[model samples]
Target: MNERVLTPRNRGFLFLDSHPAGCRQLVADMWEACPAPAVPPAGDRPVALVIGSSAGYGLAATLAGLKRAGVRGIGVSFEKGPTARRTATAGWYRTAATADIARAAGRDLVLLNGDAFSDAMKDQVADLVERRFGGRLDHLVYSVAAPRRTDPDTGAVHASVLKPIGRTNRTKTLVFDEEGAPEVREVETAPAEGDDVEQTVAVMGGTDWERWIDHLAGRGLLADGFSTAALSYIGSSLTAAIYRQGTIGAAKAHLEATARVLDERLGRTVGGRAVTSVNGAAVTQSSTAIPGIALYTGLLRGVLGDGLVPPVHQLAALWDQLTGAAPLDLDADGRIRLDGFELADDVQAAVAERWENARTATVADLADLDWFRDEVRRLHGFSVPGIDYTAPVATDVPWPGHTL
Candidate 1:
């Protein structure tokens, strides 16, 4: 077998020669690291449909469902491909690896390589549900995080921007690749208009979640006792001026509202329910790209890592809630605030105290704040145990449902 070294900077390598066996082995390793939950044989294996299943929280959720729920089949939708340089998106490698693992475990994993935002993609998903699982999906996860989405009804395309309101807010940030050093800076932002906020809401918010339900219900693909959920986050109040209180916040607000409508609609189907898992801050590609979030996440990670509440732990908790293993509390707006639990009164109070009073606060302090930074690194497929980093890796890889 050809060998290659995979690094944190390079992220992933794509092998030209399909190493089906090797891929299966790697999948087995990942599966062993995180075993699925056991289910009674008499209980029907739940069918899970995961959109944006390529990476980040979506991938974690998919793995959790596979291990914990004994999910027999999984349908994943992601839009990614090999770059001209022959490097696959991290999602592609993950999908390929996951497929091999599922096949070995006697599970059916169907991947759809298409735009989840388009009507055609919706139709394709419905068709897959009809043909593959006899028209019923027990759980649906809406995890797509796109900056822009075209309006299906209006035939208009909208773009999302991250910016602060009025005056430019300067803050300190952490450079993870730079040994966790603190750097002070001013936030550069794009000019925003009322329409910008509305467009962002329409694109990133809950309309697609509702549409997914509407399509599934219309096609009789939603099984009785079904549940659906979308993930959202309110990172930190410091960044909230640009994030939670800005265009993205508007989108999240819309998303939270849409969940209620979906809950009522799905309630009629199978006592089906709609929920939004407000996730904690982590170092995702989406999260990292946000202007002020890196610093915020870094600080939170440091704080949480010091035996404080971590996002992955919160993710595990969210999974428990979804599996009916635990009860969920919601804010007045009817959104399940996983992050709220992470940022509980005491935790937030401590962080606020540090932010207000820490003199000469340095990068070391931030990195050592909590275990969150380490968890964030792990979330991006880094810093995992027992993986040989020196081994040569392939640059050409294929996910099961991708057709070039």
Candidate 2:
């Protein structure tokens, strides 16, 4: 019986360990708090596949399908299991907990742990769909976020960078000072050099997503009227130079272009559709790692207060659009805009005003640093409510579901 109390270890933007019990509790809370869609999707119980379904927007999309749309789901993610020396990643515990909750609610949500970008993994999922899910997919959601990706065709490994495209980006960002306290400081990210843009697009772009659709569609997997969405973000001008106008932005643009291409192809073949859902900012692991995003989101919390939409709530709205319960609020480029509130004129004006006056000393007044810190801690199963952090818990908790 090996057990110990796991406290969070913060190493800059990373957490060293995750608490199994705390992560379970966090997932349970999210499942309970998620609001059901106004109207469930029509027809029989739908089937969905959510790639990168263990965390962030992917998790939200999974829950939206299972709980709101009454869909039996297959979730694909890459998560490291626990060992004697270290606990599993937060995502491992989250998936396990989600499986438990789904079973209790009489819903089916299968989790598959592996590199979803690989051809082998795609084949595995397609076979599973044939055996267990009626051989058709009603919806497919792509929300993978990773540092690097291996090209399944060329065996080339491409790594993504957070650098600006043409010029060095200097901006005020959140950092831990010498005292290990949150502080506002200016940081400079140098311009991308050489093949940085191409490499970034290779890693985070739409190529893999396109491959997934092609593989599934070729195998006659996508159902009639099927819908697919890939999550994206378009941040404000505050961090645009390092985010929306950076190498990652180029990758996102490629993603949007892929969505358009897929929409046309799917519509022609199966009467299906594909969209890039531009989501709002929230406290996600990927968001916190961006250079200026922590500062910008903190200011969002300070100014917007309760007006800011959480990820799950945004997903509920998305479910409505997907199910025809509401209209698809597409922007000019034919992408869904779930970020309207965050981009509203008044909200941006207030946040911009606060940004200009932000200094280390004045940051407390201008930003919700406590909320920012707590959200980061909460991501790794720390600082959760009603969790006995002092008590020991098992480290090697396996998901009580089939894994490949």
Judging by lDDT against the true structure, name the best candidate.
Answer: 2
**Tens digits of per-residue lDDT for model 1 on 224-330?**
87888899887667777788877788888898889988888778657878888888766676776677566666555556664444333555566666667667667
Best by TM-score: 2
The C-alpha stretches of model 1 lying farther than 4 A from their native spots are: 1-42, 165-168, 176-182, 188-191, 306-316, 356-361, 369-384, 401-404
The root-mean-square deviation over C-alpha atoms between each candidate and the true structure, in angstroms, is 4.5, 1.4
Task: State the displacement of the C-alpha of residue 151, model 2, in Å, after optimal TM-score superposition.
Answer: 0.9
Let me know the TM-score candidate 2 reaches against the reference structure: 0.97
| lDDT, residue 9, model 2 | 84
RMSD of 1: 4.5
For all candidates, what are the clash counts? Answer: 25, 0
